[model samples]
Target: MHDPAPMPEVQNDEEVPLLGAQRLGFSAGSQRLIRDIDLTIRAGSRTVIMGANGSGKSLLLRLLHGLIPPTEGHVEWCERPLDTAARNEQAMVFQRPVMMRRSVAANLRFALSARGIRGAERAAREAEAIASARLEHLVNRPARVLSGGEQQRLAMARALACAPRLLFLDEPTASLDPASTHAIEQIIDQAHDDGVTIVLVTHDAGQARRMGQDLVFLDAGRIVETGPVAQVLDAPSSAAAQAWLGGRLYLDPTHSSQT
Candidate 1:
């Protein structure tokens, strides 16, 4: 019922635990989806990944989460490798979440318990996550059969249930209805305020602006631009970035950007 501790003060130029990439590239067999990308999102900051589908936005998040190993360079969270500790410190929510075939409460319990949560503390944390997403009514429902929107909220709840330091979201609101999307975004903002550094991938400009302090624009396996969202959107550095924001879609969202 009680809110968690307030987010710590994060001043620019202050030493922060960063989720960083230096010339990181992701390859599949021989296909490289991202290349020569250097990015550093400060701890407790909110960053967005914006681009047309298959611009390597999702892949880049995976690489950052250590779901996929980079073919070149490396990703680090605060100078440490994305080992178990780092992975535990970070959590990712996908557009279509991978869900457990259990009640929503059970799913939360499974995830949080895996993170070593227990006792009244775990119950409080689970309730907090559900309440934060405004999903208290659905906590006892079957997680698998939930509507697309509710499912997404549960995914978010599961992610937040761990109280991770870093959160990665790959179009978390893409399939939800507007109200559900709004709810999810609100919870995301709350999460940001709670001191979890965020890397959010989305095509929705409005969501990006609301949630992102900075943006990374990717196209054809390359980073077209990286800067404050206001700067990058208002004055895109490249024609590709311009076209990307204009919704002239060129990349496929289905396959890896190999060519």
Candidate 2:
């Protein structure tokens, strides 16, 4: 089959902020979920966050994305706090998308409307997003009732419709079939080519190897190893990461709780 067309670059109003966390920490009551995270996400990088379950991968993503407030540290973008302006330039997609009860087309329209695009302009944006996601046939279907793969495509389409400069995805293909996963990865690649900085969290090591330029490996709420994809995955610097990559770092079931 021919390669899928890349997404056309759409320049945003301003550049994506250089995201960084300074001494970041987050606690859930007495349990510290993340601790002392000092990291920088440079502009135009495809950064992937990977770790064992309960190792603070998701928590760190949420904290950095400004979805949850940090307990003892701060996150900033472009030397400023992660306030409304910074947040406005970002978008996120979760594993299981929560869709509106309306039709697929209406759901996408809602996202565009929220971004202040309306009338014929909204229609054009929606059309483009739908075509990119290959959701034309599903336009009139109820969004929530579509199959899992279709719902995910719609969710990604809706997020992309807003023209975000930064995109965060948390295990977006965690439960997808092979074909569906491939579709999602292509969409992600197109977004990256279009100048959207991407940060993704995934447990699938192969997925990380395929999509990541930079790798961040976490263990017990700390960054055990981080570097370029091949370096960290091939020549791990930490025992924990080595153990993980070697498939010997399995945790007990009783301690199973997500980060």
Candidate 3:
């Protein structure tokens, strides 16, 4: 974890690719958003995607998770195609988290019940998730009535309830205060220790350094560089990545910062 290498040290686990996107591309009404990408995500490593606005980072993540079909190429999870059943082992948390109109505990229950869990087992799971996110006192409060930071924590707890083998985080801490962000970072570290493959899309350099060993750098709908975090952030191989990592490539700074 100290070295920011592109490929994590291979583990003793069996040969199984957690995620693979080959020659992936996406288009909408003659506008291509992402193009000709190939990526393979291994288990037990945190691979972060970093780039400027319109660099196709978010779009590429969605494609890899099988939320949207690629106009070209395909995605695979664990040797199988990225179908619904295959995707169930993975979970994603978006930048602006949306919660139900119900109580915080109710939201957790709904997520667990979706995976066919119910009753006392489900209630215990909800309590544990809330405590993990430091929201135990807010369990009975309405989800929507909570503060912005609280809502994001709930989104995180909900994602953890499923115990996914792979987790996709798209700016999960984008709108949070420092305390909230730090709390979620600890939770993610815990999840990583529990053997969940983590793919995070973020622009914060420090966050990248902490969580990312390998990096996926995208620009203008194409992957500009794919390698170790040190190479991509410290000594970026591509001009776009270098400028981005150095904080000098923004066309408009406001659009680039998550906050």
Candidate 4:
């Protein structure tokens, strides 16, 4: 696919919301998977979304990233409607990333190429991404043959290769070992330091605290609480937040409370 036409850059003011969703909702058949989510992602913030297994954390992420249209409301980027031009500035890494049937270096090349980069610039980005992900030794190996952690690292490298302004991750380290998880977090940290806005979804509380500046807690497809990571995790005021933090099963009052 060809790259979308370039969009004029937004000013670098940190206070400006880079992305926003107003009353966002998503439904499948008779069930509303996401409900009335009003969210703003600052230009240089690390926002983490956390919730139970069926709380719609992933769904919310998808909506915010414009991977799927919301059933109600809309998403905006840089105060404009979210469209192809806006989405071109974003990238997402999924739980089980799909690698192309090609070599590690080839995958990185493809990503940069897709962004309309070429020649020396593309080569530099490929090298930098490979080095950042510590995949230099495996550059010649087929991406699909790499281990789970290696593949995830490559996925991150591929996403970052495009130099996106916003990065979305959904359980990128859910099945990795501690070392792999740490590596992934380091990449995320580096990306944030480079002014890339981060929005991640993870069930690991410790990971949330380590990577998040702000937290969004979801319960029953709705936002229950949002605040600084420390406050939300330590002194959560909402019952849903409290229950999830305390290891108790959170039963949304609207649903059955009895087991």
Candidate 5:
């Protein structure tokens, strides 16, 4: 992986879209998982993706983050093709974050080292990440031995330590306690305040309202609605979105849901 370039200074123009997908799609053999998705994510914006169990939320997030190749269409970063340099500027945290057998501090150091950060700069970043995630007490503990919440926190801190310009999280707070969830959200909030663009996938309506400025609702591999968080959650126009926000199950007659 190439060393990530320094994040560009935020321009005054918020209208310029930072990332985009044109007719994005993914499939497993004959089954189409994600259908044609056309979306734009503005720089420094907080966008949330919400959907039912098999609504292709996580798959879409993976496509946008370039973790897996799409079967069709393309993703763009800063008006250019999504390439290694663009991916270097992005990071992702999964629902169940994988941790090294090494200590918490070691895990963080490894990530920074991979980014070519070293010596005093690396030390500074490590210290900041430890503090930011409040992992000082557990720094010496084996990362894999930490509680679910601690491991998740470490995963988030490790990602942030690399100074990614775009952060993608897939149900980061799922299965975590309220307190732990709040802690993670606070860290995400801080990152956003520091000009990191956030793209999150979540099933929690409350979390969506708390962390999202823009909302995208997907169902049966297709986007049903896209709008401001409040507008979409409070007054969703699409039948699929309405059923989801209304706490009812929505099954698309035309498409089979992917699990």
Candidate 6:
């Protein structure tokens, strides 16, 4: 097939409707993973979604990314429905890096190619991504054989190579060492600076404090509270949020500070 044409650019900051979810919910059989999640990711906002392990943080990210369909309600970007065109302008990194059975450099090249990038431009992007991830020495190494931290960095760089306008990360540094975590954080910061809107899901309070401009706290599949990071993290109006920040995990709403 011939090269895919470029997607029309979002005209301006205002044109970027960002991400919006209305009455979003997801259920498997009789159990609901997420419910009534009404949220909006603003243009260029470093929004962090925080909750306990089973609070559906990862599921929520997948729902918004359109990787999974919501059992109820809808998701939108740039005021348009979440469809192929919208998804094409975004990228996602999961908690566990999923690498192809190929060299690190080759993996990045594939990601770029999928986005219709080729020729000298593709090589340039692949080179820059490799350098950014500090994987110059591992260029020809098989991706799946890299150390855990190295694989995660390669995953991040691959997503960045797509030149996405929106980025969704589901605890990308969850199991990484402090140094590796810091490197990923720096890459995220640079992506935001380069005009990528970020939505991150993490349980690490320290990460939230360092990168969150806004916070959305979830408990038992519901948003307990949301506001500027300082307000929500420091002075949460919801007792459930306070307790979670205090290291208390409650899967049952009745067990939460707020009923």
Runs of candidate 6 with Cα error greater than 4 angstroms are: 1-16, 251-259
Q: Estimate the overall C-alpha local distance difference test score of candidate 1.
A: 0.81
What TM-score, computed on C-alpha atoms, does each candidate reach?
0.89, 0.89, 0.89, 0.92, 0.93, 0.90
In order, what lDDT does every prediction score?
0.81, 0.83, 0.82, 0.88, 0.88, 0.84
TM-score of 3: 0.89
Error of 5 at 52 (Å): 0.5
Spell out the clash pairs found in candidate 4. none
- Candidate 3, overall lDDT? 0.82
TM-score of 2: 0.89
* Model 3: per-residue Cα lDDT over 30-75, one tens digit each: 7778877877888887889988987888898899988888999999
Off by over 4 Å in 1: 1-15, 249-259
Of the two candidates 1 and 2, the one with more favorable lDDT, higher being better, is: 2
Please provide, for model 6 over 1-259, each residue's C-alpha lDDT reduced to its tens digit, 9 standing for 90 to 100. Answer: 1122122121224444588888888888777778777777768778888887788898889999999999998999877899998999999999999999999999999999888999999999999999999999999999999988999999999999998989999999989999999999999999999999888998888899898887887776777777777877888777668778788754553534222
Report the C-alpha lDDT of model 4 over 1-259, residue by residue, as the tens digit. Answer: 1122122122234788899888888988778888778888889888999988989999899898898999988999999999988998999999998999999999999999888999999999999999999999999999999999999999999999998999999999999999999999999999999989999999999999999988888877878778788888999877888888898997765643121
As for TM-score, the candidate ahead, 3 or 5, is 5
| lDDT per residue (tens digit) for residues 186-215 in model 1 | 889888888888889999988888889877
Q: Flag regions of model 5 displaced more than 4 Å.
A: 1-13, 256-259
Model 2 CA lDDT for position 130: 95
Clashing pairs in 1: none
Which pairs clash inside model 5?
A: none
